[model samples]
Target: MESALSHRRFGSSDLMVSPLGLGTVKLGRDKGVKYPKDFTIPDDKAAADLIALARDLGINLIDTAPAYGRSEERLGKLLQGQRQDWVICSKVGEEFNNDSGDSHFDFSHRHTRQSIERSLDRLKTDYIDIVLIHSDGRDEHIIQHEGALEALQQCKQEGLIRAIGMSTKTVSGGLLAAELSDAVMVAYNPAHQEESPVLDYCARHGKAAILKKALGSGHLISEQDPAQAAMHFALSHPGVTSAIVGTINPEHLRENAEACQRALLQT
Candidate 1:
């Protein structure tokens, strides 16, 4: 099979990206919360090695969020000198304070600006490749969040972000976002096929559709053989430009890339 990373293009952006993007949600959280058993959060050095390895293997797009504990900061430290070559996508609207406390969502213009600034400081980058509004699939929130949307547009105009998008959990929310934003990151997989029509709608409007939870948040890939099957199903979807997979293990990353190639061939 050919290298899946060679399969590129993210929406209408000129930036070419790997079909399998790196998701950094786990990187910011404590291992206990993310995984049931004992799992180690890799140190800065180890994480840097993983980042270097991923780039070496041709994986370029990295998705992270401020809500993910120290992920943006850790990735910033790991990719210190070579940030320009990769596409860094981060989300705003959610904030993580303490591990024990409930997380909060603030999509106001003030909070949006503050969130983007904090992310930039943590990422050590002047401009983010993409900044997505992290919405939890609530129509009321979308309808009431005009200020945040305006702020995001302002940020784009100011050159703080290359593209604007929304990360949604529902097909309707994704469709709504696709109508307003330049791209969308949605939970899309064979297990949840309802979002396919939304993806197609996004494609028709020239908006990029980025797949999240492509492996059902690790459930689909809990077994060895099924991992490839799940990934193939995701990449084979015509509406998806790339599928973001989260894994600290380099071998699993390679498997995802291979699965993408198989999907491309079959499609």
Candidate 2:
């Protein structure tokens, strides 16, 4: 199963990525999740199968974060031989405490550098394709006051990261991130379009816009053909470089990939 999905330029970066990225939040942690139902963490074999299935279905991008429990560590083991086959996107600024089932935020210069270094070791990679600041709802403050993205820029210059941006929670933050970085992860779906302006800005400025919660974070599951409908709506926008869908289920992964291919074709 060679990649059948077309690759798109990730903003101004040298790397090309698949439009449908595999989000790995479910791969590591189950507690503190907002999914419609609770799920058990998959074992090693199951995790490996899901990763392989994603590659076979033409997905080349994998999104994980330090807040996503052991996702980076597990991926480090699972992707040992196929590192170059995927464009890995990890995050900093937020750390999940497994013991407390809570998350804490850190946007300082020193913490930013340490986070990236830890991610590189956890993923067993020399460099990450993209590293976004996992915002803690204070998008404006984080960009303007916290100086997190600036730290990421330094890492990029040092060749530790290929691209930098923020998973912004607001339109203003999304736009600001696009202005300062190579890409942004924005939440956009039929149920919520408040960040469409961010997408428009990305389209006009040639910045990469990766969609988060494109399926309404499973809230849209009741809709008919939810995966196809959600994916089509998200990718129809010329601004969206890719949409991250976090599903450990093989059937759902295939459906999402097919839906994205159809949407890209129509576009």
Candidate 3:
């Protein structure tokens, strides 16, 4: 029994993701985060339970990255039984050291291919639903000079990735990425609206635009229900395919989903 909310499609890609994808950053990395409060990473049981809850709540998209502590690995194990139910979005280029909490990125041909293969192994999946270049603020340089984008295209051709995109930093880079990739993840919230141009491009082109940091990465703390407002704003945009919101707490996850439900109903 799939929730109707899971049936929304992302442009021409085969990925029919949920209108509100669940972000798994809090599931993996707690350090170097923008969350207002500190939290211990959930244990394996808790993680598995949370994924199950998300599915029951009609969320089909799960965003993960190697840069997140062990999110891919944990999901690999936790989501073992029903692989078809999820549209998992993983990343390349950035790898975080668990012990040091430090990160390094590589977008060369060799590394990009190697990283995707490793991601497939870690995710315990035959093919990843989406693979985004986790840009390090050098969005244009990475897309133009680096071999990552080319590798992703090759992977798509080889049937390893369903779609390819970039979690872009700059507007120009985002526009370029929208031109080249299947999707683009941009940071757009009420507090920051710099990426509207990118959203506009995606809408105009029928490319998928996934909004990240919709709640300002937990920094937009005010009493006016910022989470609801942010989700509404992100989805209200014609270009936005879905809003990715991450939370470790089951209660918070449900609350966020309710907010998304409200947001979707508004239009």
Candidate 4:
């Protein structure tokens, strides 16, 4: 667990997170859009052990969403009282509607409220450290659903969330959210650096820029040396406050932490 990796400030929020955060989307049973055959859902005990290993390695940020099947519930049951020193970030505006057999986004205020309550219940927490509006690059969906953003703002005012952010696929979507929200989480990496401008905008506005899909959804780590190079490339970006990499393996977690340290040393 001992390494040279250290913590950094998470944008304007008072919370400080490790450069490498845990992404729990894969922990969920339902893998939307992607082929189900590729999904690897970890057992509850294995997931808990992974979290404990990450904590021991000095990582404190855990990002999950209600749309991610049973991930929240599993995290709740595993890391409940054992993890008091962690920062948990979850997203609203999306849900796993079993009737549709797919996840759907509903930015309605009613859905937002329900999503937050459900996330709280599943996470077994009173307040979430960060709440993000998960948008999949749909302008019409976002413009038509102003109430969802307003609901997040209201939640921030009510102290249900420490900070509000937008998770989107496009730069424009992220930029729009950066202007309206407290932080922005977007897909960023060496191969696809289209979100650089959005990251700069977030940096200028004092909003956190969280990098998602940092390894291009496991493409970067398909090989050994490339994985380290990809991690270094993502963390080398000045605007990225942290990179959330999905993995339930403690060995991979340790390797990623070492990669971050290597990146720091190289810089």
Give a tens-digit lDDT track for model 3, residues 1-267: 333464588867877988888899878898887778889998988888888889998999999999998889888998998999999999999989988878999999899999999999999998999999999999999999999999999999999999999999999999999999999999999898999999999989999998899888888866888888888888899999988888888998888888888888997
Q: 70-168 in candidate 2: lDDT tens per residue?
A: 999999999999998999999999999988899999998889999999999999999999999999989889988886888899999999999999999
Off by over 4 Å in 1: 1-4, 31-38, 221-224
Give lDDT for model 1. 0.80
Clashing pairs in 2: none
Q: For model 3, what is the alpha-carbon lDDT of residue 246?
A: 88
Clashing pairs in 3: none
Alpha carbon lDDT at 149, candidate 2:
80
> Ranking under TM-score, best-scoring first?
2, 3, 1, 4
Candidate 2 Cα misplacement greater than 4 A, ranges:
1-3, 221-223
Task: List, residue by residue over 1-267, the lDDT tens digit for candidate 4.
Answer: 366358888887788888888988778754453532375688877888888788888889899988777888888888877657788999987778545658777888888888898888989988899899888578435745567888888888988889888898777788888887778898887678888998888767787888988877776544457667888888777778888988876798888888877887775
Instruction: State the lDDT at 242 in candidate 1.
Output: 82
Point out the worst 10-residue segment of candidate 4 by lDDT. 30-39
Q: Assess candidate 2 and give its lDDT.
A: 0.93
Point out the higher-scoring one by lDDT: 1 or 2: 2
